[model samples]
Target chain A: MAVRNRLTGERTHVPSAVGRRSRVASGPHDRHHEIIDAALELFATIGYSGTTMAQIGDRLGMRGPSLYKHIASKQELLVEIVTGMMDELLRRQRAALAEGGDVRQRLSSIVAVHVQYHAEHRYEAFVGHREIDSLEEPHRSHILDLRREYESRFRELVQEGRGLDLFRTSSDRWSSYAILDMGIGVSAWYNPSGSVTPDELAATYAELALRMLGAERGD
Target chain B: MAVRNRLTGERTHVPSAVGRRSRVASGPHDRHHEIIDAALELFATIGYSGTTMAQIGDRLGMRGPSLYKHIASKQELLVEIVTGMMDELLRRQRAALAEGGDVRQRLSSIVAVHVQYHAEHRYEAFVGHREIDSLEEPHRSHILDLRREYESRFRELVQEGRGLDLFRTSSDRWSSYAILDMGIGVSAWYNPSGSVTPDELAATYAELALRMLGAERGD
Candidate 1:
């Protein structure tokens, strides 16, 4: 099965039984990426607790024991996929915020980036949001901290826009949640084959976000 | 432990080890509700596939075999909980829409009801969204039909508002998704002890929804 790498938007092939027989030499780094992608695909399809390491090996056409060479355990795979996703989201959000337009432009950019990321990384978004409880201990707290920081970026924009009088909102906090939640929701229902493209969906959501904030100008 | 009944939102007491000794007489109907509530609480805390009838019985201080008297299987419990939620949502949505109001008022009432239902029934909302995959066959499709019907109520309002020149939206479909998703998200993050009451949160979200639709007037 071919699974898309969560970190990079690239397809990584996990060989089927027939394809495994014709495999050529692949580097450990490539193997590591393939294993993570395979695990991500399974984790999203099946619940984390319901997925087994052996099933992941089966999907990749590797022996269960041989799979340990690339990854330690199932929980570690979840940690990697989720944290990697959050890290990427935070990176993009920072870049978007730094590419300053006025507050309206920045808010729109942020919402657009958010919607696009959730749409593009649907599997990561699914597992990240659904499997947060399964992520153990310090890793869970760390991921949550990252999420809070990411959410604050939206809230900060709303506050900034409010201060500048460019936006009028009933409550900056709830407005930010409404905006962010709606964008996060893209992951649940976005269909790549659907008429709306990710970029177009992102643009529409951005317009909705601006409208939600009562922005002075129309997009 | 006391579990809140999903259907009625009443707190049903499931006796602890000590409390089980002092239990008063309860009818089978009451026992059935208590069992369902316990199962709902457990399913929300632990994923559906992870929970067992043994744990449900344990939580309610009944022998595992005794549970068969109340419910047939774990899947039945899920079917009941999910379908019950969808049914109730459909009922409330119809009531909200049937109340005579302009398009704006009707839309606001529907959003308010949705946000408040999700906030009050957080456990049901959590399980309904996350455990849809766990629900079997015809039941799943049936619940989904109810959901589509419920969503159309909002979309119809948006379309009506547009026809009346009260709402100017980029796309009626995406706008409805944005409005509904934002309200559904209250289930994930709403804190009962927070400064904002559910009614207050509902009002704020309704305002945001109107703003998102580019409604002509403010609340």
Candidate 2:
């Protein structure tokens, strides 16, 4: 799986001006990023219910109610974090689809994007997988809708392969589920400090995924 | 996938009557089962740390200290629940292996056993997957050993398929991971009340698993 430039987004590092404003204006965007980072770490370690605003505030070197100044409630915080993660995933998927490639290449690109996203943003992936039900009605539905769209990309690719007589699987839906499950499982055990880079892991997983769907390698 | 007895052990559900001297032990075995049942539900819902002995006691209509009289510690409770679940899995895996079938049949049987075990024992499976790491040292290692042994059964089947020329996949390890991940993922979202029975889901998953390994039917 080739790493496409489109898959790369702007680095999240704060600029000098933004850093100065973070100390002065108490910017919503800066506070939003802080809340997300803190929530991600807490959610990963203690899970959703086990984490609280007090604990999140402790991590941010602020008091409990100070967190409310930035975010409304714990459920709201959860929705924001989950929605942010899903939105990023949607962004990556769109970028992968937009890049110039054949069906096989595009599918591989999608797998790579998924693997890389999960590996680099494991906290978000964990929250996404585990805490979806914590969101309220509209937010929950919106996130689930985005997730369905993300999954449809893989299903469409599988159908394309079937159209080319490359895949003879019984059900495309389950095939897509299997592939997505494998990709998501990467977050549970993948260690960046290990031998394989995220790109290499993505490549390995993409190859396996293609083989699972009976896609032949195009020389 | 035939439900054959393979473990070569006593299939008898011997109710342990040794520890019923306490007031909490009207029927030691029944009470023990009840404790495990409640623990599984609480662990799956609120997670390990979020669950307390007090909550467990309240759920069972007993006090906190009473629970200690039955199980030594919360850690012990976790170990007992996980061990019971793993033991059942081992039994199913042995049965699948002992059915004396071809590579494809054996592989399907293994997948079926895995999915069926999780589907039938959803609470146990959920606790085993999510709260396993919360177990302390020796107990943790014990469960890990059993899990490795269980995984080896499937790995051996994959190797057997490779030796029999039934698999077209390049990497046996990846193939095994894919099948195992698919089975474990089933536990995360499977609803017994849904349209598909555990047996049907197992059959579907097994078919997909075999296809992923490039195992042709009847091969």
Candidate 3:
């Protein structure tokens, strides 16, 4: 059977009907996205070790071999999902940094992006938090690199705020960790059907984060 | 070969000396603690659904049937572990509250207790965060009740601080969640061999929590 590797844009496995559907359902930019979506649901439910290719295949209505058409291995699939989430997070942070607004606005935008992204893509966030370690050595290190880059964005913002005398925190990294912790925790319990919308939740968290940063009320 | 029921305070399953030593080397209290420890480790690694009696038994160097002699079922074991952790948390909170300090001091003590407990009992903390949903109806509700009660301690502290005009946050419950999230995240990535000791880490977090609560710097 001829294998077409959708991930690397190379030929590795035969394009079965399931693989064909995955390719067709997701446009060129979305192929990786669909695999991540399926992975998130499976990882959240059965956890990283317990979830197998066959189970993810079942979820996507693909045969076990057909899954290989999209990705090389289970570990690759996990790496793709976690990397994708972290990449998007980094993208938002970069945008916030480049926007060059006041510290308050920039910080608010950061919190908003975090809360909105996690709320909209809860499965990815959940899996990223819980299952990233399951990836093999190179893949795991790559994910960690992305995570550290993402975290550095917040740390930089906090340090900048402190430098400008806008805040007075003892340690900028721990403060940033605390804020990110709150944002990540939203995935565990926040529900769209609940009273608060994602935007509102983000705004609320922004206010709380700003306060935590020692921003005055008018700031 | 009678099996001794070490858990129920009855000798229902009195095993032979060899079997007893191989099955449960620890005394009743020690054996129960060992089971909880084993369950916590398994649950943290594989999650609740992914872990089975056989896997936990393997951790204890026993077969599935041998585990049954100590605990009625996997669910029972999970309940005991979760409840034990929660009970310890509540005791810590009560002790902190009973220290009879002002709001900031009391809040700092609470944060220290929370971070220290979660850092020391990392596996149990992971299970408490991730696997509470897999519990059955009554057990699930009972665990949730314990969680809600535990959460209320933080909320009450925040509310008292608010009454004293210490906190500037809008929602007490949300602030409580924020503080708890920081402490919970400690279990996810804390390394004792790293730069910070658990006590120092807890102190750092306690300072951040106090700042988030808008407590006076000196207080």
DockQ of each: 0.60, 0.29, 0.33
Docking class of 1: medium
The fraction of reference A/B contacts recovered in model 1 reads: 0.79
lDDT (C-alpha) at residue B37 in model 1: 94
lDDT leader: 1
Full ranking by lDDT:
1, 2, 3
Task: Please state how well chain A of candidate 2 matches the true chain A, as a TM-score.
Answer: 0.84
Q: After aligning candidate 2 to the native by TM-score, how far in Å is the CA of A179 from where it should be?
A: 1.7
Candidate 1 lDDT, B1-219, residue by residue in tens: 555455667755664445332244645436678889999999988879878888999887777778998788889999999998988888888898889689999999999999988888888988998898888899889888888889998899999999989999978999999999998888888888889888898888988899899999844
Every prediction: chain A TM-score: 0.85, 0.84, 0.80
Query: What residue runs in model 3 are displaced by over 4 Å at the alpha carbon?
Result: A1-80, A102-108, A134-138, A163-165, A215-219, B1-32, B46-76, B100-105, B216-219
Would you estimate the TM-scores of all the predictions? 0.85, 0.72, 0.73
The residue-by-residue lDDT of candidate 2 on B68-172, one tens digit each, is 777778877888889899899998899888998888898899999998887778788878977666787887788889989998878888888999898777667
Candidate 1 chain B has its poorest 10 consecutive residues by lDDT at B15-24
Task: State the TM-score for model 2.
Answer: 0.72
Ranking by TM-score: 1, 3, 2
Superposition error at A159 for model 1 (Å): 1.8
Ranking by DockQ: 1, 3, 2
